[model samples]
Target: MASATEGAGLSVDEESPVSQKREERLRKFRELHFKRNEARKLNHQEVVEEDKRMKLPANWEAKKARLEWELQVDEKKKDCVARGEDYDRVKLLEISAEDAERWERKKKRRNPDPGFSGYAEAQLRQYQRLTRQIQPDMENYARQREECGEDFHPTSNSLIHGTHVPTKEGIDRMVEDVEKQIAKRSKYSRRRAYNDDADIDYINERNAKFNKKAERFYGKYTAEIKQNLERGTAV
Candidate 1:
C-alpha cells in the first residue's frame, strides 16, 4: 500500500518542463506586442499634432488677396464698358513706385538674363493695357471666323515674337500652348535662366544651334511642316 502511494506522488511531481517554458514564452510575447501597439498609437498622435501645427495661414491669405484683386479688375472692366469706351483699349493705371519695384524684382528673379533688364514694370503695364484693348476684337474675330467657316489666324504686331493678336479663342489657345512649351523647356531653360553661375552666352549659343537643327529637320520634312502649319503648332 505504501509503495502504491509513493508511486502516485512521483507521478504528480513529473509535470513537463517544456510545457511550463512554453507558457512563460507566450506571456513574454503578449507583453512585448502590447508595448509595441501602445508605442505606435503614441507616434500616430504625435504626427497628427505636428501636422496641425505646421499648417500655414499665409497661403490662404495670399489666395484671398488674389481673388479680391481679380474682382476689382472685373469691376473696372464693366465700368469701362458702361462708359462706351473700348474695354480692350483701357490702359493700366499707374501703380505705386514700391509696387513697380517689387514687380521688377519678381520678374528679375524669374528671368535673370541681363537682356531681361529692360523688362520694367512700366513695360508690363503697357503690355497688359494692349492685351486688354485687343481682347474684345480677338473674341469678335473668332466669332466671325466660326460663323463664316474661315480659318482664324490672328497676327500680333507686338515686339514679342509669336504674340498672337488679340482674338479671344486665339489668345486663349496661344497662351495655353506657350505655357506647355515653357514647362517642357523648363528642365533645360531653368539652369540657364535661373542659375546665377550659368553663362548666358553659352545658353544662347546652345539655343541657336538647337533652332538651326530644328529648322533643317522641318525643311526636310515638308509633310510634317505642313501638318504643323495647319495645326498652328509651328510656333
Candidate 2:
C-alpha cells in the first residue's frame, strides 16, 4: 500500500523529452520564419523604390544645373549693364578656363559623332532600319517555298532538306511582330501628293464622289454654261 502511494505521488510525464525538444524547435522555427518574412518585406520595398528611381529622367539633374547657371549669368549681365560695363566682354570674353572646358564638353554632348566614322557605319544603320521594317509572314513564305519546291531551295535530297521546319519560338515571335505591325499600320495613312495638277474642290473623298456624281449626271447640260461662266460671259 505504501509503494502504490509512492507510485501515484511520482506523476506521469505526459510530454516526453522528444516532444519538448520538438516544441522548442517549432517555436524557434516560427521566430525564424517571422524574421525571414520581415526581411522579404524590406527587400521588396527596396526593389520598388529602385524601380521608381530608375523611371525618373536621367538628364533632369543636368538640365536643372544648366538652368541655375543660366539664371546666375542673367543676374550678372543685369549688374554689368547697370555699371555701364561691356556685358558681352564680362559674359563671353572673360570666361574662365573651367567654363571653357565645360562649354566644350556640353558642345561635344550636344553633337556627339556629328559625322559618321565611315560610310560603312551609315550603310549598316540604313540596313538595320530596313531590316526593322521587315516583318516576316512565315505562312506565306512557307506557301511560296512549297510552290517553288526545288527551284528556290536548290536541294536535291528529299530526305535531308525536304522541308523547312519552324520552331515554336519563331512562330511566337512572328505573331508578336505581326500584332505590332498591325498596331503601327492602324496609326498611319499613305500621304497623298500635295501638288497634284487636278484641282481639289471637295472637302473629303465622299464629297469628291458626290461632286463626281453631280457632274456626271448634269455635266452635258451645264457644259456650255460652265464655259461661258469661266469666260465671264454668263448673265
Candidate 3:
C-alpha cells in the first residue's frame, strides 16, 4: 500500500522537460493573443486621432471664409459711401425739403372728410381712457412712497429722496406688480383691438414730445445725429 502511494505521488514533475515544453507553448499563445489585442487598441486610437486632425483644417477654413466675407461687405459699403450718389446727404436733404413742400401743398388741396374725424375721435377716446387708468396708479404709487417715511432709505448714506430699502419681500412684490401691470396692458390692448394705425399714431406723438425735449436739452448735438447716421448707417 505504501509503495503504491509513493508511485502515485512520483508521477511527473511539473518542471520536467515534457511539462516545461507544454507550459512554454501555452505562454507563447497567450503572448501572441495579448500582442494582437494591443495592436487593435493602438489602431483604434490612431483612427480617432486621424479624425480629429482632419476636422481642424475644415474649421479653420470656415472661420477664414466668414472673416473674408465680412471684409468684402465692409469694402462695398465704403465704396458706396465714397461715390456720393445715394448717400450724399447734402443733396438728399435739399430734395427732401422740396418734396416736403410739395406734400404740404397737396395736403392743403384735400378737404376734411367725415371718416377722418370719426377715426380721430375714437383714438382720442382710447388715449384718454388709458391715461385715466394709468394716472390713478401713478398717483397712488407716489402717495404710498410719501407715506412710507422719509427715514426709509435704500443706502447706508441717504443721498436720494423717495428711496426705500427693499427687502426680499419688497422686491418680490415689485416684480409681481410689474408682471400684473404688463398682463393688464396686454389684456387692454387685446380687448380694444388696437391695430398698427394706433401704434403708429402713438409713436408719432411720443416722438414729437421726445424731439421737443431733446431740442431743448441737446440742440447742440443736432448735427451729431446726422453725422453718426451717415458714418454707421445706424441709429
Candidate 4:
C-alpha cells in the first residue's frame, strides 16, 4: 500500500509540470489572439478616419449641371453665328465715357513708359547689362596682389590675357568660379518640363500655334465649357 501511494504521488507531481506547460502555451496563444484583434480594430478605425477626410467637393453635382447648361448655350450661340442667323438674345454691356477714360488712365499708369530709345539703343542696352554684371571681388584681388609680392602691381593687360601660373589652388579656384557662373546662368535659363500626355487636338504645328493663341485670348471666358466638354457632360 505504501509503495503504491509513493508511485501515485510521483505520477501526480510529474503530471503537474506537463499541465503547467500546456497552460503556459494556452495563455501565450490567447495573448497573441487578443493582440491581433486589437490591431485589426486600430486599423479599421484608421481606415474609417481616412475615408472621412477624403470627401467630394461641396455641391459638385449642381456645379457640373450648371457648367453643362452653359456649354449648351455657347454651342447653340456658335451654331447660330456660323449659320449667319441673327442671335440677338444676348445683351451687350454699355460702358460710360468716364469709365473708358478711367480705364485708359489705369493702363497708362500700369505702363512703365520708358521714353523712346534711338538707333544705338541695342548697343547701349548691351553695355548697360554688361556693366551691371560686373561684380568686383576686392578680397580675391587684394589677396592675389599681396601673394604676388609687394613690388607686384597689376597692369590692365596682365589679368585680361590669362598669363597666370598654373597651380592646383589656381585650377580649383577657376573651377569654383566656373561653377558659380554656371549656377547663376541656370537660375535665369530654367525651362518648365513639357508633358507629352496633354490633350493636343490640332493636326499640325501651325494649327497648334493658332489653337494656343485662341486659348490665350478666350480660355478664361470658356473654362466651364471646356471642362464640360472634357467630362462629356455638355448638353
Which has the greatest lDDT?
Answer: 2
Pull out the clashing pairs in model 3. Answer: none
Write model 2 residue lDDT over 1-235, tens digit each, in one string: 9998777665445446678899999999999999999999999999999998798899977988999999998999899989999888877777899999998999878933346778998788757765968777788788877877767556565454565577797788879877976998777787654658876879988898798899999999999988888789545
- TM-score versus the correct structure, for each prediction: 0.25, 0.25, 0.22, 0.27
Better lDDT candidate (1, 4): 4
Better of 1 and 3 by TM-score: 1
Task: Provide the RMSD of all predictions against the true structure, rounded to 1 decimal.
Answer: 26.0, 27.2, 32.8, 30.3
| Weakest 10 consecutive residues of candidate 4 by summed lDDT | 86-95
In candidate 3, stretches whose alpha carbon ends up further than 4 angstroms from where it belongs are 1-6, 14-16, 58-235
User: Which one wins on TM-score?
Assistant: 4
User: Where is model 4 more than 4 Å wrong at Cα?
Assistant: 56-235
Q: Candidate 3 on 1-235: residue-level lDDT in tens?
A: 9998777666655347788889999999999999999999999999998898887875877888999998976776687688755534544555777798998999999854334358778688656655655424565566667766564344676555535454586578668867976887687653334356532413565686687687788878776875786789653
Q: At residue 146, give the lDDT of candidate 1.
A: 79
Superior by TM-score: candidate 2 or candidate 3: 2
lDDT of 4 at 110: 96
Model 4 per-residue lDDT tens digits across residues 46-162: 999777657656786798899999898788789879988655543123456788799899988894535557758756875676666667678877877777764357575545345
Clashes of 2: 0
